[model samples]
Target: MINKRINITQKNFLLFLYIVILGLFGPVVYWVSNHNTQLPFTGKAEKNPIQKRMSIGEKILVKANNDAAKQEGITAFAGGDYVLAIEKFQSALKRVRNDPETRIYLNNAIAATTESPFRIGVSVPIGGNLNVAQEILRGVAQSQDKINRNGGVGGKLMMVEIANDDNNPEVAQQVAQKFVRDQKILAVVGHNDSNASIAAAPIYQDGGLVMITPTSSAETLTAMGNHIFRATPSTRNLADTLANYAVNVAGSENVAMCVDSDSQVSVSFKENFTWAVYNYGGKIAPFDCDLAAADFSPEEIPSQAISLGADTLLLAPSVRKVKKALEIASDNDDRLTLLGNHSLNTYSTLKDGQNDVSGMVLSVPWYQKAIARNSFIVNAQEFWGGGVNWRTAMAYDATQTVSQAIASGAERQNLQQTLANPEFSTQGATSEISFLPSGDRNLQGGLVKIKPGKKSGTGYDFVPLNMDQIIEAAPKPSPKGATTNPRVKSK
Candidate 1:
């Protein structure tokens, strides 16, 4: 029923937008096709020409002729060729994620003894953060393709099944339960939000499954258990990096912050940034606005900062609010420097706000410019038809790390102990992958600034700004209530 015929490029771009608005929450969706769709399994031609469309989502492969394959497999089973029967049935279920009929045949055949495909479960907030989930799925799906094409991990074909949790804590718990029910699922690769990941952790921990997250960097998740790990840096490290940039690099004496009281990420960052700023001899403004209103007033932002004598303004709202704030800031003549958290590290911010976002600074574990310096960026861009964001990059790294673990002989039984080994390390697109004794991502992130450019899809790019740019002359201290209302024109 998908009448929308978008080209591959548009599909990729649209999915990127989905990632930015995920914080707002939405319904989860899955891409499904009919059971009778013709597959690569058989050569039979239909009497009627059926219109067909290719899915950009994961195509669960089906048997060319399920009936024929089942019969042949049965014949092979009767002939005592359990290996042949298992092979035939396994082929029947290659792209099929769940099929009880063939699953029994394949399991029976495996009992007779032979190599089998390794299955992994991928869980993400597909509905709530479709865009981020899409990018992460692409990384995982493409990695699965690459590994299978290159003889797979440990010589066993890699198979994956995807689940959508919509980023809800309860929904994530259900997804985790489903993953646990599927005994063949040796490991899991998801639960994007820190809350959802934390909610699902106990199930995975008790179920004896390996869980590796790509972008859930909340500070408390790693304490779940030995079975849990992540590819992105912890919130503590990310906040420290950004705080250093704000206090040491940006050299701001007074930091004013606007936070969303409803967002856990904002709250966590507020605490970290506050401590980091104070520790580095930078004082925070007395007036801190914790606004829960989504459609917050832009005029109030500058008014608060201008009146509080703040030299720099940090925003912890969603992208839409940030864009409005930027639009408002661009017209102001108060010489206020705008600062952002990792949430603003997205293509939509620059694409929608355009010139307004120029000079805006943010901190993330990975940036497109820094990633481009790595060799994997080229191939990833060529394959995905756009630049890979932090979500995609981290997801790719997570897959590579897990694949290496599997190749190095880590199994469901010992994967926890194996990943916990301090000696264990894997190379990634952005940097080396390793876990700490606390099971947190032992990583150091980079800081970036938006510079004028026409190269990126967003009409600007994130450039790695080091200490030199951070040490620029601090804006002259403005006396409280001294500046005239520069926003008079906008009003």
Candidate 2:
């Protein structure tokens, strides 16, 4: 009986041990089974809100197109092996020399491996407009490389974190918030579109962070806040430059305007151009066409303009309507003087239009040949393997502005105050940079005309149009209603 009772006691003890073991390990096993794809739930495994939105180190490589060397470099970077990261990034760059993002990563890795670095965030449309994004990034990367090579900002190297906003307003706001949350990021140089910049401006303003936009030029951005600054010339300035040239220099009296009604930038440019044209003793033609119209016919624009007694065609298409603008340019077939805003200053104008766009005058924010700083051009050529456009120039200027402000004071509030100061000024790729009370740059834009040239690599180039060239290209006075009946196919 004693042996039997002992056996029962042992069986009960074994059963209790099994229950305790199951209680402790069952949930873990279940969790492991359910979450096979995820890491174990440690506090370190949890991604922060910033990580969810923005890519960094190895994370960026995953999101972007990747190669073996770049992947290794990013892995090393994520693992805190800065030396390996730098070496691998350099190796990767040797294979793909024209990639701006890899160059930037290499520069950042170099900065990190060498010294303590100050960081800034650059938000761009990496997914939506990869080429444009790279152009902007080339400017930022060039500025960073130059600054680092020249002993950096008081011996602390500058590092940049790239954020892909994809030019979406919602994504831009998210990126802005992420940037504002990170205390290490001193300032931001970013947001390619006016709407994107506008969406993110309020967030940056509320957070007291300095946001310098390289390309956005909407008038609404002018008054967003003291913290928001624009490196590019205001829309009114660009429009006025084009209008003055059209009327006074080009001797155009009657201009037929093609506008994209769906785009704020287009409408704003047209309105400002109209005001400036009327003030300069020129009149807008009565017949106007909307580029954004669903049934808009580019082939008929030229014939209609001729019928309405227009001596010049002003294209105010948005970035989305560039193809339409180019189609109109082809349809015009050199019958009338062509003028466009900065929106049309794209490679498409040179490649797609070719001879069709010759002699077309465009208002641009900066021209490389016209800039006083030859060093910027030389360094850019060496760094990027080619010439860059106004976007690059303006982006470089924006980064220079922030670096100057950071030199005055690295703290966010102090830097904002420094940029807002009336005495603040810095020399940039575009010339001297100074801000008005409205946070708009006190600068004028340049005008360029497309011409056949061997240097452009596209059989055409945008030659800078000086005042003399503008006057020389002016057409002789012709009859107001002179119509050349070009063949038009009705849509």
Candidate 3:
């Protein structure tokens, strides 16, 4: 009886061990059998995938049947085949419904068939961190329309590729790579964000592609290479301009700068501005100002400005912080002349805090003059549903610069050379825009003040100020026996 029980136990243990081993290796064996049945296994094939990938050569040669017309169009367009381009664009239009941009491209291509199309790529933050990307895109579209309407570049219709970079650095690099690969594309207008512009600039420089940043204002952006350019003034430029206004226009002997401590642009602006103020013989008031705190009293800057006897309160903070400080300053000091950089010259500023910044001073690259006469600006009211800002104006300028460069017969690699020429100037919306040897636009910018009864979309329109006008307006005695504007001498 004992021997029989021992044999049964041994058999059971062996069976259990076999089941456990099979359980551990079952899935692997089954996968190998099924996957290896179709193709010879070199142990490199992807398992459980829905489709197989083609080799590089095969992928390059193959064209999709679904997008055959679009592919052919792209090929023809890139190869200087305008007749084929027009045909393909028309075919694409018929197949792709609700695609306004495609229709616009087709119409422009049809209208300007004398010469081949000149393609320009545009990268904007369309998905993630879509801060004013739509507005920037509208500016680009307006430029495209105006350029196409004005007989196009070199009598060739302008075609544009609008890509979304999401304002992420990695994504912007991908966008730059795509632009480099497209042979038809000669120039790009994009990267409104400073970081994105900085990230993609190296790729553009290496690819020999011309990249024009519309609103990026980082100090080191143009230092990347000769192929990179910006239409907007840098933070240092804005800082210097603001410093001049603080001392000369606002007549501030002691200027208190309440800057955002966290932002690189703010730090750069503050450093450059401090030196500029010192050079102007103006005193710097030691104010304990912090703009990076998540929660703080709005009265921090105003109280410091008043305590230090600062005649001018220069605000360099986010828009929200600016509005908050504006309210506190306007209520605290009746004689204080609030000053800001280009960031404050916006419709939202007028709409949200007009009364607070009623007598505010701001220096910017574009203002009423550009807004009044440029065809793009004139029609912007109807197309964009409001007045245009500096971003829009600068973006439009960048596109126009590229168009003018191409229209003047600068082709392929010659475009950057022509743009770098000292005599090369393009009629921009704001003024004649030409690049410096360092790829920075040569501009001094302009100053503006908020005035009543001159309303636009937001609240009141900003009237441009001259040094003489501001000086003459200063020294006027107020009803409260206080000087709203202090006396100052202009150079």
lDDT of 3: 0.68
Clashes of each: 8, 0, 1
1 or 3, which is superior by lDDT?
3
Candidate 3 lDDT over 87-192, as tens digits, reads: 8867865775323344444544554465577788777765643335655656666777787877776667776666667667777876787677667788998886
Tens digits of per-residue lDDT for model 2, 1-491:
99999999999999999999999999999988988354522333135443444544555522454777888988898888989998988888778776777777887887787667889999888877766788888888888888888878888888888888877888898788778878788899988878789999999999888999998887778688989999999888898788879898888999999988876677778877876777667788987699988899999999999889999999988777888999999899889999989987877778888988899999988887754558889888887778888888899999998888877765776788898799999988848999998999998787988889976589999888785465456443334322321213230
Q: TM-scores for all candidates?
A: 0.69, 0.83, 0.68
Ranking by lDDT: 2, 3, 1
lDDT of 1 by residue, 282-375 (tens): 7789865755665666666777687888998887554224555555556544467778777677666777666766787877777655443565
**Which of the two candidates, 1 or 2, achieves a greater lDDT against the reference?**
2
Clashing pairs in 2: none
lDDT of 1: 0.68
Top lDDT hit: 2
Candidate 3, superposed: residue stretches over 4 Å from native: 1-116, 126-131, 294-296, 318-335, 370-377, 381-386, 467-491
Q: List per-candidate RMSD values in Å.
A: 18.3, 9.0, 12.1
